[model samples]
Each structure stands twice: as structure tokens, then as C-alpha cells.
Target: MITLINNPVQLKRELLKVVQKELKDEELKVAKSDWHSRRKPIGCGLTIHPGIGCPMQCSYCYIYDMGFSVHATPYSLSGLQLVAALLFNKYFYPTRWGTYLAFGSVTEPFLPNILPKTLEYLKAIVEYLGNPCQVSTKMVINDENVDKLARVGGSKLSILVTVTSLSQYVYLERRAPHPLKRLELVSKLRRKGFKPFIFIRPLLPGLRAEEVDEIVEQAKASGAYGIVVGNLRLSPNIVKRLISEGIDVTKYLRVDLGKLKSGFVDVRVDGDTQTLIRERALSKGLIFLRRACCANTVSQLLSGYNDVACPSLCFLNEKVCEKSCPSQCKVKAGGEPKQFNFHEVIREVLGFDEYEVEVEGHTMYIKLKKPLRDEKSASFALSYLFRRRIRFIYE
Candidate 1:
């Protein structure tokens, strides 16, 4: 199942042991997940699923299918999920820094009953772990827990609010809060000095252009630092459910997934519609990005990069390493197409991580002693480093 996408040397496809002695347990853990298909050299990606099940059930959510809780269960998760991953990774992967610890990938982090424990969990990560983490949810939030996250992890943390339509009738998500309420929370998050981002995702193929614009405008007005838009993919069961519920989604979605286990049906977004959305955000000077690898496309990544400012400031405590890019870059999947000395490029430019390197053709993948990031330059530099190999990373 691991397609090489035309890798010339296929070093990445080699066994993890190829870099085993060079990587730590944490790095190895990161290597375990397919990264959903990203070939970046970022540190690690941790998803701590302490809170199971989200009440704000979006019909399009891919969670329940994963068997995470449909209800909040703080005690259900390994309390040490955060600390264990960090300490172990840091112990072994000392030089490389992982950029994110995404939450709510399995369940919402701020469900009402889960909020109190969720706060405690946030406390655990920020206070105990060092990696900057992120989460996106649709639940209505008050300030108490937000403060805990900020205090513990600093701006190295992020809370993404998932709001599909500002329209009452839209109800793209039946159980979640109204779009207006989400707007209020976005503002509150920024006022408290935290960087808030919006995931106006699963932009259903039926989502009207006006609806898309309204979401973007509202996110901007609510003081969101950026917007990560995602499109809706039809899962067989969800599609059937929506049809039975009388929801007309055909025009808004393009995936032919009426039957389960038929494999993943490709979903196509109307190019013109996508263009309209991106253009509006660019005109308004907002940072717009797609939410996934193949879903976001290469051009979306190529456009709208106004964050010349050191985005790490938005990162609270974790040192925001510059993105390691020698220059400004984009919404693209990989980075600038070029090669680097895996060990030397970042070592010379950012001055961190003492590790061994392996170079294959135009690409140079690093095995860092520690994870890197604190400044945008460092982070971008990593992507820039990977861009050299991107031409073959994605086919």
C-alpha cells in the first residue's frame, strides 16, 4: 500500500530501521503513521485521544468510523499520552523538534462534559510536554480552559474552530454550535492573546459560494489568525444517512461513494469555486491554507502566503523556529524543489540538532537528534529542504 510516487532512490520507503539508530522512539512513532501522506521533515505528529466521541456530530466527520468515543471520556485515554511521547522523543530525538501535536483528530477536545477534563489534559501537555500542538473543534468554549492551554504550552499551541456555514439552515453539523457563536469564541481567543485559526472545512460541494465567502469574512472579522479550508468527502454511510434525512448534497459533493468497502472514491471540487474562495481571502490579506495533503492540492499551497512575520510569535512557548525556508513559501504540499545537506543545511542555518544524514539524488532527509522549530525561518527551512524532493514526493 505504500506507493513510492516515483521516488528515485526510495530512501523513505526503506525500513524505519534504516534510520533506527539515528532516530528516537518518538521519531519512530511518527514514522509509524503514514503522516496521512506528508513527506515533510517536521518533528513528530502526536494525536492524544483522551476525550472520546464528539457531541457536535458533523455528518461528514470521519471520526466515529475510527472507533473513537462519541462521548467524552478523559479518564479513558492514557494520561501519559502527552508526556510519554514528548520525553521519549526528546530523549531519543533531541536535536529535531516536532511542530505539532494535533488534538480532536479522533474526537473534539472541548465537548461540554469533556471540557473540564479537557482543560486538565491541556494542562498536562503545556506543562509537561514541549512540542507545539493544535486542535480544532466546533463546541462552544468559554475562557477558563483556553487560558490553561496558553499558559502551559504558550502560543506553540493552537485551537481550530470548525464552522461550516453561518446559516441557521445550513446545519452541515447538526449537533455543533451555531456559526455565530463560533465567531464569538474566535474573537475571545485572539483577545486573550492566543492565535486562533478557522477550519471552514468540508466545504460541501453543495456549499454555495456565498456561504463560503461569509465563512471566510466572519473568520476574518472574528480575528482568526488563519483559515484552513477543507472539502467534504462522502463516506458511504454518511451519504446514505444524509439522503434519508432529505439533505440534498449532490451538487456540493462529487464523490461516488454510495457503497462501503468500494475503496475511496475520488471527490473533485469545482476549480472555479475554489478559485473564488481563495481570491477573496487573498484580497482581504488573510492567511488561507488547505487542510490536507491531496485534498488541498498543489496550487492552493502555492498561493496566499502573507505570513512574512515570524509566525512563531503566534506560537506561545515552544520556540518557533523559522520554517527553514531560505525564502517565503506557500499552501503547496511539499516545498521549493531543490536538494540540501540533511545535516549541514539546518545545522548551518538554524544552528541546532547534531545528527547523521542520508542523501539520495536531489532529496536529503535528516535524522535529527532532536526536533526543530521555534522560528518560522527554521520551520520553513525544513519545508524548503523537503521541496527539493517534492517533484517526486507527490505524483
Candidate 2:
């Protein structure tokens, strides 16, 4: 630990404490299973870390446990081997939905530090793994990279902008590009004909709920395909810092420490809020949907029963996103937490483990973890399984 600071020895030590705390702060335990989930919001999304650590270094980020606080910088692409390195077996168990890989949760994907070879590794996952995928980012992406990704993504690539708060003063996102810039990216995405969506997540407590509506409207107008709302889940220290910031963030800081003890944040998106968001969607006349972790629009659609809801981001719209929100993740009362099955993803992108894949009822539902090499065969199988001749595109 190189001593970092201005000299009064005491101040120097204090500064080191700050750095150590920020980097090692209880490790936001982003284990493989922890990152991977079955019933999330972004259409069967995969919250994979392309790399570890972040350049932006936002204080409120939930990924401290990635254990990369002190690296000179994070890895750009979580090298395919690194993916296999995630403690969670699912990373290697290999069923299939390798289709919907997500980037930027644990770190920013577009950071300038990541070299081409790294990006190639990320691209190879989709191309050779045989599944369509998208990445979420907050970095200021350049036109050249966008062009490359656009060319690569074609119709299958998606760029999701994670904008939590729009107010510049909120500084919740100090190093990240401004919300306006993110909105601009949406335009770029549309121009490139790539699917674009806005993830207005981690709704800060002090910020007015109106910010939600403003963002929703802007995203829809800016050529966004849709909007998904999520709430902020804070740790005790995070909540303390938020409230101490001299704002009424307490309204949304209702996280119970008990839930965190159980391994995930208790913050949830619920009823009245869901209804409120839904009404807003109806008024706006847009394709409005909500997601948990990975499912996004697709899971919202899959969660046929509309009564479930997520508790966070319920700061505004009591009933809307709630109306469509799916059930929060939970351990089945009688058994183990349901493992995120990769059957659908696998069968869709590969077919080596040949079998009659189905559609409608049982076809889409899957149990993850199949043979690794069967990736391409799974992609081929989905065509027959779905009985739809749509070509599966990958980046």
C-alpha cells in the first residue's frame, strides 16, 4: 500500500483508510451464482462481468465484493477463462442461454483500458457460443467502438444505459457520463439500428420521483425501445451515507439489514408503485415493462401473472411497473434456491446434446448446465424447437 496523501502522516493514514475501505468494503460478493440469476428483468439477461473493478468508482455501487478495489484498473473483457473462473459452477456447468450475456455490472465495459483482444474474447462468446447478447455500460463510448459493435451486433446486439439519477448534483454517478450523454447514446443506438433501452435503476432516495417520469418520457422520445425501472438497494453504510447527505433519502432507504444477511438486498419493488408506473406507461403509450436482474422485458412477459412486484424503485408510480413486476427471488420454502437453469439458452444456441426441443409450453423453460461444445447445436436446435425460421444473430 503506497502511502497516498498530502504529508501530515495522520492525514495520509486517513486517506489510506478511505482507499482501503472503498476497495475492500466488505467485498460485494459478486460470486458467479450471485451474479447469474434466472428471473431478472432484461429479457433473460446474463449479468456477467466482462472485467473486474471500475474506472468510474461510484461510491454507492453494489459490486464491492468483486474484490478488485486496488487494481491499477479493471480487466476489459472477463477473459473467457475468467468467466470459467467465477466461483459459481454455472459459469462452467454450461447449459445454454449463453445467448443473453450482460456486461458492466461489476465493471464498465467501454473503459478505454480494455484492448481489442479482450473485446474479441467478449465477441467470441456470442459468436462461437452461439447466442445473441447485449452489454450494459456507463463509460463514454466512442464512435469508432460504436461502429465496430454496431457492425458486430447487427440486430442481435443491445446497448443498455444504466442511469440511476439524472441530477448532476446527486453525484451518485460522479465519474459516469451524464444522463444526457447516455440519452444521446440511445439515439446513436437507434441510428445504428441497434436495440437500445434505458435501465433507470438504483433510484436514489433523496431525488424526486418526478425524475423517474422525466427519464421515462425522454427515453421513449429518444428512440429507446422501452424503459425498465429499478430501485436502489443500499448497505447500512450506504444508507447512512445517503441519509447523512442532507437529503430526505430516508424515504427510499427502507432496506432491512435482515435481508442482506440472507445474501441479497431486501429492497423490493411493490404494489402501489407498480400501478403508478403502469398508469404512466399507459398514458405515454409505450412498450413499458419491468425486470428484476436479468429477464428485463422478456421475463416481464414470461411472468404471465401480473400481480407480482419488485420492492425497490417503487419511489414513484405505485401501480405500474408493479403491475407487471415479477416475483422477487426467493429460496423455495421446502428446497434449495432454484438454480438458474440454462436449458433454454443452451438448447437455443447449441444442439450437440440432441433431442426434440419444444416450444409454447415446455420449449422455452429450461434447466441450465449442459455440455460445453453443444453451443452451436443448441442454436440450430432452437430453430427447430421454436419451429420458427428466424436466424439467430450473435456479436
Candidate 3:
């Protein structure tokens, strides 16, 4: 019998070695060059793309601005190859309590042609990595596909079904499924023992108060566990598209349209709109999450996984931890042991031999003997491993 490795970094390296031995030289080379093998921004986690480009052509989507074709195509890497690439990633962690794996950032994971690949990738991740996973989609899934998803991920996967507007979906989402249909998908996911959340992303402008209330009521009635509200992010091309669709962009803009050149500009929704949604969600006894990773953490805990606080460390900020969240991550975050052998962890994980360490609350200060070539990735991995904010200093 093979001995199980308990140390996360050692286990991750061992798993990579095993996977590398199984992969062809060309496959390993391709895996190393895959986009998923890089470190993502803080809190975004690692986005696994089952497919590239999107045919749905939602007016507010930023994928087009990033140069993905309007035509959809499944990602080239196979499931095993994808896993190999993730294992090779210097920043990726291996277990459920390790790094968060997110799906459908660049493309809709459940698009008909892409769904098979999505399922394959999910199975591979669950079997090999055991990381907490989340997928956000506006696509409608049928009962059969739901069964397949449940078999592969069950409650371990956090599902976010996007429902932006009931009335404006036709104009806003053009080729995507109706908002009502997507809500049905959420209901189905919930029925199958999945923690599904109604994702109100890019909270479009000019939505009436009653519509928000109705959405909250409908979501609760459909058995959704929670709701996630996201602000609109607009690029110049996105602004032009929305303007052509007859939606007023002026009220949502905080800066001149010319200022939004390449990157996305976050449009601030009024405080009342945000408060109203939060109030309605809380009144209905539904969990409210500001970020997707928070939902991932809650889903893992609710699924009977070991009690792990939010890996994104959102609990450090009280404003981000909604009181309605069942995990009570804020309280759990404070309970982590403040003392541990930092020397062993740094030496094993970062290959650092000499370092001075200080721990204050949820923050860990490390003074390294020398600067690392990639301090950002090192700090990110250490933060996830230690469940603390990692601040690095070099002499």
C-alpha cells in the first residue's frame, strides 16, 4: 500500500512527479505553457477554462474586449493534461483546503459543446487535487446534465447560476437562455444536493426595486441557499455596446468614457440598491456573499468537508463577511493557532533556509535572508497554507 502524504507541499510535489511520469514529453511541454499554469490575482483563484470564446454575446461581457473570438471552441488540453498543468503551477495547492479552483471565468463552462469538457475537468480535479471548486454560468442545464454534475462533484462544487434581469434578459443577454430558465437550473441544482446561489452579476443599471424583491423571493422559493451580488465592470467597447442597446450608461459612469481605454471600469451601484438586495436576501434567510470564494468556502463546509475558514482570507475584513453567512468565517478565522514552526514551513515550501518570522493576529511577517524572484507567488501560496496575510521583507 502506498503511504499517504499529509504535508500539502510535499504531497503536491509527489503528485506532480507521478503525473509527469505518466504524461508524454510533448504533453508535459504543452502543460507547462498552458495559461492555467500561472498565478492569478489575489482572490480570483485559478480559473480553469473548459472552453474559449463565447457565442452568447452578452452585451456587458468583457471577454470580447480581451480578444476571444465570438465563436466558441473547447479548450485544447484534455482533462489529465489540464491537471498536470495545474500541478506544475508554482502557486497551486493540492487539497480541498488548499487553493480555490474556479471555472468559467473566460467562457461559459456549460455551453453545449463545452459541457463535456467541463465535466471531464471537474472529475479530474476532484480525483487528483481534491480542491474546492466553483463554477458560475448563465447557461441552462437539463436534468441529465445535472445528474452527471452531481455524480462528479456533488456538494463539493459550488454552483452559481447567473440571473441578471428578468425583463431585460432578452435585450441584455441576446443569445443566452431566459432568466427564468436559468433560475430553474438553480432550483434543479439545489434539489440535487448542491449549494446553488443566484448570481446577480454586473447588477445592471435602472433595475426597479420590485424586480429585485421578486428575484429574492423567487430564488428563496426555488430553494437557493444564497445570493451573490456583483458590480458592473465596463470597458469602452462594452459601454458602446450597452449604449447601442438603448441602456443609459451615463448614470452608471464614474468617469469619462474616454478614461475606460483597455481595462474594465467598475461602475458603482448606489448604496440603496446594494442595501436593498442585502436586506431582502437576509429577510428571506438566505446566505449573502459579496465574493465567489466566500460561497466556495461555505459550500465546502456545508458539504461536510473539514472546517476550513475562507482561503481568500476575506474574514480579515468585517465588511466583506456578511452576517448572514452560515460559516461564521470571521469567528473561525480568529481561532486558528497563532503559533507554529515557521522555519520548517518556509524551508519546505519556499526553499528558504534562513528567515525571521512574526505573527500578529491573522498576519504573518517574514523577513527573508534574500529576495525571491517571485515574491508575489511565494506570499500567495504561504498565505493559503498558513491561512494568514503574508508580508515579506528582505535584507
Candidate 4:
């Protein structure tokens, strides 16, 4: 069972100590070395990888640049150990309103070899942490797998079925399941009381925009609650692979492709294309989301977890927060922010008691006597828990 503590600082420390005491040395070692034990970026929460590598070598995948193998392997940590690692993480907060846990970032979480580990991790997260969990997949999930997932995550787990290109699936995602079959999985998920969303991620240039209407219409027909559109990011290797697959790479390139050696280059889709998707989605009465966190937040609200607004505070940005969104975040934000012991939270997170906190509207300004050791992680946890923008002033 999960307990709610009014003081987030104490809650985090107590949870960490309890989890650490229960873990074995081997578990602790695995927990310590895992990358999930670090603070993720502002919009993206901690990415939980159920496995390493992906057998479905999509042409646009960038995992190869990150040193992941083409062959898949389940993550080494067991469910309990994975939970312990998350608790040990300085940035992680546990509960329905806590840190967002996203899977299928680096590898396909629902693959046959890795599905067991994925389910184990999901069960443990739902049982112990109760954080908002989400999984994205291109694989066609069977009835048995769907039932298992429903039993474990239920409404708390947001499902994102990736369908990048219908006509070009053979060239782009050759090994993955067909787009139509994946849509069928969406229908099944909806029938089982899950609000699945069609994930049109990496909106491939010259490919995805053409089929926007058909994709949105099919998604709505398949009983998807909404559509999430993501922009494409191209790494050098990804560009090479796409070119080799007989896909055009000229229009997406602003600079010479050869000049880019390391890191990813963002390819912004045309505004008209984005407008088209948003309009189509809204016409179908389907919620259109630009960020994954928005979908996660909506799923939690619809699941009856809590009425709390988005932890990322996306409601402040109109572009990302859809007017058609059923979440009452904007209205909730208009009300008074949740009260927290800011002084204590600061002391617990920063490991010092020499800071002064000032609150104005929805933002908290912390005047620090000295510099923090890990400002990013501390700010992320505090801001997420309190749903306030944290600004540290060095005096």
C-alpha cells in the first residue's frame, strides 16, 4: 500500500532508506549503475528501459548511435531491484502524482524476449511506486499480453501504439508489425477499458504528412482516445540508413548531412502539417497532444488517480496544451497551488538548511547561501512535487 506524506522531503528520504535497507548488495550495485537512477530532462521524466537493444531495426532509429545493439536483451535488474534503484534516485518521487515513468525509450519494451521483464517492471512500479507509467510499442500485442498488461497497469498505464507510416512501413519499419495490425491492437486495448493513443512519432519528412487524415481517421475508428505527434530527430547514422532505404533525405536537410558527425539534428515539420494534424484530431473529437507528458497527465486524470494538473506545468503553454483536452488542468492551475513545506523540501533535497524560500503566484524563488551540488536534480524533484517553477538565487 502507498502512504501519502505531506512533506515531500521526508517522504523521499524515508522511502529511500526503507528501500535501501530491504535491498541486497547485488541489487544495490545494479541499482547504482543503472542510468534510470539519474534525473531526466524537464519535459521527459525518467526513462525506464526494460531491456537493451531492439531487434526491430527501424530505418530512422537513433539507438545505434547510443551504443545499443541490434539484438535485444532483457534488462539485468529484477523488478524489486529496479524499484530500489528508482527510490535511490535523487530525482525520483513515488506515487500517482509523482515522477513520470516512461518505458520504450531505448528499446522495444513489448518484444517477445523482453516482454516478461517489461511486465515484471510494470507490476512492481504499479505495486510499489504508483507512479504514472507509460509504454510505447510498434509490436502487435496479443489478447493474452493485453490481459496481462491490463491486470498489472490497468488505467494507470498509458499505451502509445507507434504508427509512423502506413504506406512506407515496409521500407521504414520492415521488421515491425504492420500499421493496420497495430491499429487492431489499439481497438482491443480500448475494448479492455484502456485509453490507447496513436503515436505518430518521428513524423518522417515527405511520408507522415501525406497520410495525416487517414492516420487520424483510422486511429479514431480503432477507438484511440487521442493522437500524439512528435517531430523527427535525425542523427548522422539515421540519415544514412534512411537514404539507403530509398527514402528521400533532401528536403529535411538544412545543412550538409556530411557535416553532422555526432549528436542529433532536429527536423521541424512545417506548421501547415502540424495544423492539419491538430485540426483533424480535433474534428474527430480526439485529444491532440504535442508532448508525451501531456498524454501521461491526461491518462492519470482519466484513470481517476488524482485531479492534479500536469507536473511539467504544460498548462502554462497554450501551444502544447490543447483546448480540446479533457483534463481540467487550466482550471486547476487557476486555483491556489498545493501547499508544501518548501523550507523542509529545500533542506532535504539540497542537504543544507541555509536557504530562504519565497513564493509568488505559482513560482518559488529559493535564495541560496551557497551553490548546490546537484541543482538540476534538486530543482526537478522540488518543482515536480510542488508543481511550481523553482528559481535559485545565489546570494
Model 1 agreement with the true structure over 1-395: per-residue lDDT tens digits: 12321221122223222344555666556544423223232222345554667665667776666665566665433333434333333211111132345566567777766666566666655543333456667877777766765675455356677776676435457777777888898898788766677776666555567877887888789998666566555667667656665566664554454454563343546466656766777667666655422111211122232222111122111222212222222222232223323444456434655655455543445555554454444545444324333111211
Best by lDDT: 3
lDDT of 4 by residue, 138-195 (tens): 9887999999999998866889999988888899999999999999999999989888
Model 4 residue 345 CA deviation in Å: 3.0
lDDT for 122 (candidate 2): 56
Using all chains and alpha carbons, the TM-scores for the candidates as numbered come to 0.63, 0.59, 0.93, 0.91
**Local accuracy of candidate 3 as per-residue lDDT tens digits, 208-293:** 89999999998998888989877688888888888888887776546576778757787757467778889999989998888788
Better of 1 and 2 by TM-score: 1
Better of 1 and 2 by lDDT: 1
Prediction RMSDs, each to the true structure: 11.2, 15.6, 2.3, 2.4
Which lDDT tens digits does candidate 2 get at residues 264-324?
Answer: 4635455555455556655775445555332332332232423211212221333433343
lDDT of 3: 0.82
- Stretches of candidate 3 off by over 4 Å are 1-5, 268-270, 335-343, 367-373, 393-395
Cα lDDT of candidate 4 equals: 0.81
Q: For candidate 4, report its TM-score.
A: 0.91
lDDT comparison, 3 vs 4, better candidate: 3
Could you tell which candidate, 3 or 4, scores higher by TM-score? 3
Among these predictions, the greatest TM-score belongs to 3
The C-alpha lDDT values of all candidates are 0.50, 0.47, 0.82, 0.81
* Clash statistics: count for each candidate: 56, 63, 0, 0
